[model samples]
Target chain A: MSVENFLILGLGWAGIFLPTALGAIGSIVGCARAGQAACGALLDVESGYGRLVGASALPSSQTIYGIVVTMQLNRQVSVEASPGLFALGVLVGLALLCSAVLQGSCVASAINASKSKPEVFGLAIAPAAIVEGFAVFAFIFGLIISGGIPGTLAG
Target chain B: MPTATNYYMLVASLPRMPRTFEVEQVPISRLRLQQRLEMLNEEDTTTVQQMQEFLLWDRQHPDRTDTEVLQEYEQLMQRVRNVLARKIIVYRMDVRTITCGLRRRRLGMDPPSGVGQWVQAIRENWEHPDFRLARQHPWIPLVRGYMEAHQPLQTERQLLLAIWNQWTRLADRYYFSFETILLYLARWEIVDRWTRLNESLGRQHFESLLTEALGEHARFPQ
Candidate 1:
């Protein structure tokens, strides 16, 4: 593919990935706030299974978004033409995938925690934020590579 | 004619019990009224502290089941209700107790006397930890302000509206908190046995008390 074509494609992918990642971050933070409130309320007074059930249900959407973005990036890379570019793309994609998987697992654990203690929901947030860091690194790296590829490669 | 002091001491000194199945057998209506009284009396040092202690113990001992903790809480609440029912002096004292619990705290050390003090007191009480957590949202201050400012008097219609508004706000907070916790749990996959057991117990105690309180007004309308 031409350099412009590759650049355009990469930019398109970035466009989708960036916004979704940002949105996921927002949603995660909102979920965290909700978790804090839930735990606080549970501490103040118990609300039974209803409280646990409700608190456990709020984090899945963001996890799914993270997974989808990384998977899509994996699909976008071309291995035959440029091995280095392809490898970098795969690395970034894997980074994103790992973050999504870890974050998703954290969310699940948090739900389980809420079911029993609802009070400890606040404690579940640290893991989710940690996973977000990996996603951020992968995203920034991918953007830089995509930006540079257009300039260095011959059409 | 047990004095408030006597009732206080009894509740304070009541021995802790192990898990029991009596909770399931107990009529929800009776439990509901008793729970309401217990919740209101949460401000009472004797009762609130005990409840807090029970919760703390359950947290420490993770082997306890939700069903067991809830049953014990119900029994305690039943005992409290029975005491309040049997003694006229205690009952009247409880009325004062409820008023005090329900009374708003003054924003300033010395709020203007009369209606203003009462209004401010309600505002303060609403903002207190127990009632504040029930609503679990940023909107409490605004809603509380409106309720305090309106001070609907005399008419049952106005009173109902005020109560409804307060209830709605509390319900919103309750649901929001629930949703938030669910999201975190789903993310974390936290399947620890002890944490789950404690949570279930805490939830049971909370619900049982709320149901007991709400049921009373419905069953016995003046």
Candidate 2:
């Protein structure tokens, strides 16, 4: 095979893996941000450390969704699959990345609010959940689009 | 050296301050606030601390002059980078300028324009109630009214409330950022100062009333 075909197939693999890779990147940033707030909140409050840490972990779901979506996108790498793979991978990755980062910010806000006013704890998490819902939308649609891509099923 | 300010942690550690000076005392003490701000690098902490020291009412030593304060304001404006933070410093100076203008005008010290345009405008428009800058600072008329009534305490409270509200708006616009931390410190200082003033004033009021009551009792017909 020519170098052209090899390069094209390589691009296809890159695309197939982008979602998981990008999602993990987003999760790393998101969790770090939320975790910092959690640690800060711990300094001011006596209890509820468990929930703050749990909320910080909320951004990790993007990685889980990414992993599942990656599995669905798994197919025989080809030039034909490359375009579809790259588009799907880059878009989903971007969505997950932004959502996770923003979700982390929302979680941090919730933690900050709750630390001062514990009564608002349950209500504040709603913003982070809404952000997570957007990420889920990206994941669900990515999974659906993966099957429609013109490629032979890996048996 | 601290690599970053860890603004998120710093901001999160601070309590939510009200938009106005409604709190009787600061939610966090100055010492504790300083401790949390220890996260900032030494250089930044020095700058921030220096800036916070400016515009304090009682900070003026007998020898301190207006030129010194104005010079410090310019120096701080150069050192600080954030636009909102810079605006905060300017707002402080504006408050000081307007108050000074009001007092100087009342004292009948009308002179030629020597300072910034705003001061010059205050001088030039001595005849005008708001100095033609009423739109920029709507509270000017209200402050003028208090001054006219010779209610210095009310004027002080109004000025403090205005500053508190400005800091509150800046804090609300930005969160988990460096400027937000600065704004928090500003509000905390206001709260701290308000508490101190209230305490002193309260003591003075109680002492005066007690003395008056005792004097009246002693003078009563026997």
Candidate 3:
């Protein structure tokens, strides 16, 4: 392949992987922090394993959303599809990244609060769920728009 | 450590027993001392004699009010607060433990939101009208006596009423759930009275109370 073809192919690959990679990174970091909070909470309280584990995993859904978007955007890589792919991939990934990390922080706080006052567990998770809603919107729109990208007929 | 001035300010804040009242000839006990202090609030003449007797019974310091007695009483009240707080913590733990066990058995996974739904149910229903009435009645003495007696897990009606009132108020203002409120009452053996009935029968009793308290058509619905 010519150098020009190689560059376009690389860009295409970047578009495919960027959002999933960034989202996974966000999920890992966010869940890790929440998991740490869960551990601390367990040391002080005798029960509530479900809330701790659930809160810690809340950010992981972003990664799945990213994967779905990535799959929806999957198609033959060519210069024609690069811009649309890049725009959707980078923007959706960024949204997932920010939302996951922030949701993780919210979950961590909820876990800590619930540890001391288990009665607040349900109310405390409301913020994280709200954050997850934003991620879902991005994922759905990304899916809707990715289908419209035009592929080149050139061989 | 507090400076001497600060210590003096703190001590000055609490009401001092009057010097004019003569100490009574009767024996002084902690319970009698508490009763005498309460009697002071009633404007009752009988309480004055008990307070004077309890205040000056000290042999080494007959004339001086053993401010130490008052200080000790304050400490006792603080201890009661501590015990109540611990009981709340343990009750929350119980909810989490139960939710966790159920989740593990049912889903083979950790609980997602702990006992959040259960907590929410308690928080929402705790303020039923019956609970409010319970709070109006003072039951601290009953609670303290039960704790002192080290009785079994049986509940007392007055104590239960008092706790339902206590926790319902907390639920109204704070994010705490019904368990925290109930456990605080239970720690003092208050809920045991309500629970003494069969579980379904107890449910019916509370359901009726909640319906009446909330004035709602279907609050705490079965």
Candidate 4:
């Protein structure tokens, strides 16, 4: 393929895969870290099986958010829409990924703190909530931009 | 009420069972008064000291479970607050006391106030022999700051009941306190202003007590 065609094809694949892949990456790493913290926490607490489990899963939401955004961006990878896809895909994907990982760390810390001192569990989750805000922004922005893309099916 | 076995023991020991029964009932009230008086003598002692005494109590009363101790404690607490007559307070207080004992703190996500000061104070005195501080928790500073800022001017036992009522009214059922919050509260025997506050404002405005006490630093609603 010619260089131009090759670049277009690359952009097309990057548009769909990058957001999904990066989001999953973020969720995986984030959940894993939080889960590790949760496991450590379980040893000390008399009982909080549900809360600890729920906290570790908090970072996993970014992955679903990423998937929804990616599905929205998936469409005819024509040259006309390629640039939009690239920008939305890469930026939103990275944001979701970063937010997820950061949220995971926050949740892990929250779980650990709550395990020892459960009263602070609500407050400890505040940082994670703040981090979730960025992911919501990314999701909304992706949704808006996807609407503007020509010839793409509704996501 | 003495059991049949206890009655036999009284008869075997005293020979005059009816007189012994009258003397026992009178002395039981006196014994309680004496115990309360003794407790008042060291009311200013630290949590570590209290914890030690509790442990000794446990050891001495090998046949009594923690539930029995808690029941006895709750009876004393009820008398102190004059709530034995209030049926509503009694029912709610029972649940709160049970929940507090089981959970060791209120259940919620809102961070307690004054966590920063609490963490700082704990770190400074981390070498104390009674309590163990978990240094690795990431939210330690935040938790400490929240508790220090929000902790009520009451005894540890009262604080448990306060949060029980406060958090329940907030309708955020799944609240909890950091272990350090309990540790810090246990360390002191602060005079309770809640009783006065409740008298003036009624029990419903317990949130206002937190607000009034916290002044500016109280961020959480309950």
DockQ-better candidate, 1 vs 2: 2
Winner of 1 and 2 under TM-score:
2
Which residue pairs in candidate 3 collide? A48-B96, A50-B111, A51-B114, B24-B53, B129-B213, B155-B192, B155-B193
The candidate scoring highest on lDDT is 2
Q: For candidate 1, write residues B14-87 as lDDT tens digits.
A: 11111221232221232332342342333243544343343244236667554564465446555543232223
lDDT of each candidate versus the true structure: 0.41, 0.82, 0.56, 0.53
Model 4 scores a C-alpha lDDT of 0.53
What lDDT does candidate 3 reach at residue B86?
40
Write candidate 3's Cα lDDT for B1-222 as tens digits: 321121111111122221211223212233533432341222222323332232233223535332553454344334433343444433433333333333243344533333322434433433332222223234434543444465422223444354445445553452222223222222222232233334556588888887788787755458
Q: Report model 4's TM-score to 2 decimal places.
A: 0.42
Give the alpha carbon lDDT tens digit for every residue of A122-151 in model 1.
786567667677667666666565554432
RMSD of each: 20.2, 3.3, 24.0, 24.0
Candidate numbers, best TM-score first, in rank order? 2, 4, 3, 1
Q: How well is candidate 3 docked (DockQ)?
A: 0.01
Better of 2 and 3 by lDDT: 2
The prediction achieving the highest TM-score against the true structure is 2
Per-residue lDDT, model 1, residue B216, is: 58
Q: After superposition, how far is residue B144 of candidate 3 from its true place, in Å?
A: 39
Lowest-scoring 10 consecutive residues by lDDT in candidate 2 chain B? B110-119
What is the interface root-mean-square deviation of candidate 1?
Answer: 13.8
